[model samples]
Target: MCRMARPRKPLLSRDRIVEAASALVDSEGLDAVSTRRLAAELGVSGPSLYNHFRNKDEILDAVADAVSAQIDLSMFDESDPRDWRAALHDWAVSYRAALTEHPHIVPVLARGPGRRPAGLRVADAVFGAMVGAGWPPAQATYIGALMRYFITGSALGSFARGFVDDETAYDPADYPHLGQAHLLAERRRQVDEGAFETGLRALVDGLSVQYELLAPGGTVRPAPKRS
Candidate 1:
């Protein structure tokens, strides 16, 4: 009585699990992902998912990290001679692109790196680049936090989507300046992308001034005490 040979390829893997979960989140939002749903999607028993992930939160974390892994960090390359302003402009654009693609995962990713390696790498690259450019350590940390807030806030929702498409929605009496507000929904992509770029440029420009004001030795001057 010979036993049947095991299949050459396993039906489930960590990568496979993450891919399925990420797709679910992308298509149906984060709440759509569950261990049972994943098991069904993967053509495996519900309990089998436990072999790869301890719980749905773990799976979601993996999915979020996978999204983080897609972000471009080359702009922050140590070998690049680009100044902090240039590097930040490039990095913020790349960061926004990644989050825009996986908007459903933005909430998870916005929670900071936690223990996720890919997320940590992103934070490290940004902070290291800022510090290497002569920003004080505290300022470098603040820069990282500021960029995260800006990028993640931009990704969290669509400004265009907030407007109603009906031309009557923006009454001429109530919103004289928003005569074309109804058109925004039809041009969601353009409006959103343009807004992101405009904000990014303004943010970097403002930071550039602050960067130049850093005192010699890379520290900011303390505020004067009131007499």
Candidate 2:
């Protein structure tokens, strides 16, 4: 009897696992991802997933890192006379864009870089760019943290989605100022994008003022001493 020939390509892989898990989260929220479900989606046994990932959390972490890898850090270049403000504005926009595409993973990504390599690279690029642009080490760290908070918060949920689409949901007797609130859901994309842009501009503007204060000969106020 002739022996059977082995298939050319492997059935399971780390990339395929992450891709499936990410897609599951994107389509059915984070809670929808599981070892068994992922295995079924990949057409493999649950034990096979273990070969690529130790556990579900590890798989989630990989998925989050994959999303992080999608972020654009090219704006934070190592060029002289770097325009840190411009770089930050562009970086924040790019960051929001990636998170918007995968809102389900925002919580995991918001947990700081942890041991995720792609997440760490993002932090490194942001901090390095700030320092190279004349921001002190401590301030650079603060800027990185602040931007993360702002971007993650923006991606967590949509303000427009909180409102009911029914015209009578916002009763004028109770909410006189929200007469047009019912329309928010219909214009969600516009409202959310506009809100993000508005907040991004305000944040960058505020940071620009703070950056100028660190200028040579500018008044740099000392931090309050702890009791």
Candidate 3:
């Protein structure tokens, strides 16, 4: 003569599983996202996750694709095609911002775009915009790869985060070159932003110069600096 048990909550779905897995990555880092952990997070049995994703890799791929969806693709124009320099700069900014938000997932995405739809979409948007702007196929592909390299490397968070703020971390007599290492941490945000912009400007500037030779007036240059 006991009252009926309250109805159980809904079982997990692929989307829910991926979302939970992503949250695990966001909160605890990549190692925290496992089948067992995801199941626990979803309040479901481990086997239920396999019903949606064959394994952790597939689940991660889905999570990565979801991240790609967060990237901004408005750099490419439908009505008034923007110059390729501006498009590339826009792409670099957007890509960096997206990956920076999910640094833990960056390494996984570096495996290559492959058959992941959203990752492919990001790659396609960048490559297609360049091709449409008259970049040679190989060069366009190479440029796409270059941007990925920069963005992913930047996302890795090593020296990119800057050296320790403790001046004692480096002894000037022992390491004269790093005497100002603490300054990096002192101005962490400014340092990181300045480095990124410097690298971006240099990359785009070099590409612009080369593209000029490759397409001789392809994608009109803008002020010979950061486009």
Candidate 4:
């Protein structure tokens, strides 16, 4: 004659808490994530989350770094030798793909790794790969920073949003070059992807040129000495 309360759903923990918070941010943007809302979403008391995270900021940091963890860092981990340019190109593509999946987190990521384990791992992998390929330590570090700057900056906006179908927006009378600007919106996927590929190749090529001059045949090989 006692009606027991329905078995409570699995109680929340750090991973579940982070997962729910991440879903919230992905759907509604970072501003929408709050301790109260997160607690409600998980059907737990607000104070319970504190047992796992110190505050909303801590949770947000975890969510941001979760994205960093998704990147493919194997190029640095593998024992087999790889062409530096090919390794860099593949890693950048993987990094870009991971970042694009969580575009909402892009702005917060520029806080610069900030002691997050996964974020630090990503930076370490990139720098190690460069240095292992014969890049001078200083140059390797700067090149890593340069790639991060380009990838994160590009993630801040969508190319599709930049175009307008309205021909009036690009009047030939005022600007001749932008006459086909309206068409860009129709080809957003192609244009955005194409632009990233072009820029990445330019960076790799330019770096290769510098490496050849400094180290000779390529970044990893040394020039022959005159007899």
- List TM-scores for all candidates, in order: 0.92, 0.91, 0.87, 0.89
Off by over 4 Å in 1: 1-10, 222-227
Error of 4 at 45 (Å): 1.2
Writing each residue's lDDT as its tens digit, candidate 3 over 64-176 gives 88889888888776664668898889888888888888889888998987789989999888888888888877889999999999988877774634577788989988999
Weakest 10 consecutive residues of candidate 2 by summed lDDT: 215-224
- RMSD (CA, Å), each prediction: 2.9, 3.8, 5.1, 4.2
| Ranked candidates, highest TM-score first | 1, 2, 4, 3
Q: Candidate 4, which segments miss by more than 4 Å at Cα?
A: 1-7, 215-227
Model 2 agreement with the true structure over 1-227: per-residue lDDT tens digits: 99989966566889999999999999998899999999888888999888888999999999999989998988886753448888898999899999999999999999988999999999999998988778888889989999999999999999999999999888899999999999999999999999999999999999887876675744466655899
Residues 1-227 of candidate 4: C-alpha lDDT, one tens digit per residue: 99978767986788898899889888999999999999999998999999999999899899989999998887676674667788888888988888888888888787789989999999888888888777888889999999999898777787866988787898888998998888888888788889999999999999887787675433345557999
Runs with alpha carbons beyond 4 Å of true place in candidate 3: 1-7, 160-162, 215-227
State the displacement of the C-alpha of residue 100, model 4, in Å, after optimal TM-score superposition.
Answer: 0.8
Residue pairs with colliding backbones in model 4 are none
Superposed by TM-score, candidate 3 places the C-alpha of residue 82 at a distance from the truth, in angstroms, of: 2.4
Q: How many backbone overlaps does candidate 2 show?
A: 0
Candidates in order have lDDT scores of: 0.90, 0.90, 0.83, 0.86
**Candidate whose lDDT is highest:** 1
> Model 3 residue 14 lDDT?
81
